[model samples]
Target: MNSLRAILLGTLAAGLSAGGALADGVVNIYTYRQPALIQPVLDAFTKETGINTEVLFLDKGLEERILAEGQNSPADVIMTVDIARLTSAKAKGITQPLNDETVNKNISAEYRDPDGHWFGLTKRARVIYASKDRVKDTSITYADLADPKWKGKICMRSGQHDYNLGLFGSAIAHWGPEKTEEWMKGLKDNLAHKPDGGDRPQAKSIAAGECDIAIGNTYYVGLMRTNEKEPEEKEWGNAINVLFPTFENGLTHVNISGAALAKDAPHKEDAIKLIQFLSSDEAQRIYAEKNFEYPVENGLEPSEMVKSFGELKADTLPLADIASHRKEASEMVDRVGLDDGPST
Candidate 1:
């Protein structure tokens, strides 16, 4: 906590020690990510490269803000969650394509654009968590989450969250708009609680006996397990079991939190350098463990937290499908009226 505070304070003040500021690099980042989450790769880059880094961490609406800033934006790179943010940035022409071979080689074709527009560093899967005592004979797929028996027994984060949007996008890719919307409506009707808090809170609610099931990314469970301040987190960890839906019909839906270069970046080279560095093997390993996520590169073991939760198959569906259908996915959330409180 103290170290994270120092990093935040230092970055906010741009208060580099007397000597570091004179170096050959300063990369400004617009991050729709928490400071704690990205600090590992950021600090490592600075340690090795002597670059001064400045980050503006905002939780929501980074794309609109960047578009509003235009050329005047001081940001060199923008990092965000899910394909929606990355795709929207590319679609709006707010991102610069990275033509570097190192990035192209390291990130997979499914995780990035062939045009080198953006790159994925880490992956998160949206899978099912059922209270061991309550949910029997777990369903085989996300489609099964909408089963009539599961109605009023599920806990999920808000529909507006990017994670849910990406999952919806995957559904659209497979089932088409109309069928996807129908599924969303059914899923909403089955929702046990109003959309509130993040994935962890939904899990915590399940642990607290407010719900019997949760739909969240794998990492949140990892994070909660490591949360030192919340002893209840231990019980939170104990309350549910992970079930990766591999029903032989299709792959599970997953999403990524990734980075892209600014369209009119002021420090273009540094931005590319940072992206390149994050995609490096060392940095990716650090990201995998520190954030409790899966690396985009092959052969790295998933973080221990993910391992503890259980093993699962990732949906091999191309990520672009998530971007293409983000709109309809969101509309179904509103249309289904799944806006009840966290635990009903």
Candidate 2:
């Protein structure tokens, strides 16, 4: 870990030296989100507030990178996907609590940290993609995925992937470790083949009749449907119906792409302004339209392509509660041999 941190810091220092020092009017960001996914909102923020912004995109180790930079870290704000990543940033002590009234007012309590350590910008449901030709059921529950009736009729990516962990974590929050473990075992037994590939491939598998149903995020459907470059992806998107599955509590499981105020921020005020703007209606709309994610702010409609997935009644369970169980959920996955697929 130490060597890796040094390499990351060394690479960053070289890049920063070449770019020269950032101006006082700028807020530097270190993010796990891809640059293109967030550029529109940042551009709008600069236009509206006249505060320049810089982004450093990282695929992983965002918290570790900031930690390595320490008090001298140039990061003022951190943006990333998943409740787990957001909460992990806070837990790593790289984040400071943000208590802006505008942010608190715009985002709901369920989506924000109770102590204001992080805030959700958008939501995506962990939904079921059912083959239109093979599946007759219009509605299903997370628990139903384990039923013997669907044996050899499901496909999913690795059970230990962060996305699956988030969903399984929510199950642990709702059902506790024991029942959730049994459900994991049962679900494992129902797999059509060894869990493999990303969410998009699960859809492609459905299109090829490898499985009747699969678990995936809501936005992948929109992405695949709109992808002109890979026209085959459009066929994958069209092969299935997106179903909003619920827990026994009657609410859909959702995760977030969210932001946090970085600790030791050099530009604290501008960082706050940036975070506040993200929670604003304008930024929320931009997020909805560009990313096909449900805006965290109330009364904002998702992109039209997303709306066609039907109404999402997201579970009122605080994401923090779900995040709390992620470690245990991961442990259960290995314990049940979930990623090893079904037994003979």
Candidate 3:
């Protein structure tokens, strides 16, 4: 990680030394998303629009790197997988506000920033993964996660993880801070073990008989099913059924994979064109299909693998509301020691 950071920092320094022109017809992107997932879309964009793209894939510190580069930063767009990261880019003042009819028309209001700092490209539900044999409940709700009946039968990633924090943030947004804190405590006490690993590992744990139910994103199930390198993961995928849990007053909680325009972009016009194209139905179809995520544009649908999980009724609670409450959610994670699991 440190070596990758140093390399990116050096690249930024070189851009600064070279006056940051980046040539015409080229868009420089700094993304936290893996290149493999988005490379096909970029290739398609270049082929159709004649605008070459140069992507710098970073696992962390995209905002900090851009901050360090100041006005000399050559980044045209910033793409990442969560609402928190996109909001962080906006909060850091490193992203430009974009106002375009194409963007507005393609994206739903809940997924787009009112100030146009960021726009979500795709959506993912924070759904439940239940054991196919051990768990028989077909209907579930997010609030039911706090029920004592499921104690010690739950598996989860760290509560402090961005995905969980986003869910908790939505809880706070809907249920208020006190109720959210109590729910966090109840959910923590029900953990089968100390929270560890990413979403996929939760399914792995269920297959290992460590837990009966796990919380994970919808796409990890797809990734596990398609994981040719690890055929055992197919077993894990097959051992579970997805359940979209909803809140009492709202629909199921969903987060996004989104993008923002760089504040000091060298190729502004090209950047707008690229973001517009990404929001278009053609690009959205390719983008969502690549990862088994639901497309953000209305009238578009998720891939067949995603649809097989059944329909998702996404909560209309604006992403801006949830993003605003993340800090409190993160603090509650530590306050309740959610990652520590139940005290033995």
Candidate 4:
């Protein structure tokens, strides 16, 4: 996989050096999101605007690759998951402020960068998945996870994973570092096993009786439930019920899948147009139905599968604020030895 990625990157750099950016009607993309996930929307953009798009997908090193390419990078727009990546791109000087009125109108202020460096395209909540046969309560709070009643009954991914770090960052925002650390320690004490694997495995653990409840993103449930290609994953999805956990503020914690304009975009105009189109009603609907994520655009509804999870009252805390404390949250994770599970 690493070799293939290196070859792709080498080919891309060579192609860019040879031709610079593509012609007037074309825009290039560098995305952390899989191309298949965003291809439908890109196809729609091409159909409507007659502007062609070229994508270079990478799982990691997106910013570094662009930085390495300097002013000659072919990336016109950068698309990625998580607020931390967006903010980190901005901090690294790889992204520039968008400041477009259409993008601003489509996305809520809380979901976009305050300075216009990035805009959220969709939302997914950090939620709890409880075993359908073992757990019954629908309403749960983040604070409740720390109670001794759940000790040896919880499961999660690595503490340093970006998803958990985002949630931890929110904890710091709401409870302050010291209190959040204490809460994290309590939560760690409840681990069913050493924190490992992605969100889906956590749900699988619940189904297999390894744990009663687990932390995961809301959309993973939707994906697992509808995945016809993998029947076992369908079983994992059916084994749990979604619970919207909140802070004392009465708002659920949510994160974003977002995009930014590349700093040295050679196709700036078309890139901006593509981004604006992504926020439009048609594109938003496509994203919602295709990805099972909440649309950033107001009045757009998520897919019916997602609607089954119940209402999400997303916390109004600015993601930028959450991004600010991610470092501290990570430090606290190590300090409490969260990834070591309860044994340590």
| TM of each candidate vs. truth | 0.86, 0.95, 0.94, 0.94
| lDDT of candidate model 2 versus the reference | 0.90
lDDT (10s digit) by residue, model 4, range 301-321: 788898998898888899999
| Model 1: per-residue Cα lDDT at residue 208 | 79
Model 3 TM-score, 2 decimals: 0.94
C-alpha local distance difference test of each model: 0.76, 0.90, 0.89, 0.90
Q: In model 2, which regions exceed 4 Å deviation?
A: 1-10, 13-21
Number of backbone collisions per candidate: 2, 0, 0, 0
> TM-score: which is higher, 1 or 2?
2
True-structure RMSD for candidate 3: 3.3
User: RMSD in angstroms, all models?
Assistant: 5.5, 2.2, 3.3, 3.3
Weakest lDDT window of 10 consecutive positions for candidate 1: 15-24
Predicted candidate 3 versus true structure: per-residue lDDT over 15-68, tens digit per residue: 432433376888888999988889888888999999888778889898998887
lDDT of 2 by residue, 242-315 (tens): 99999988999999999999999889999999999999988988976788889885478888899998889899
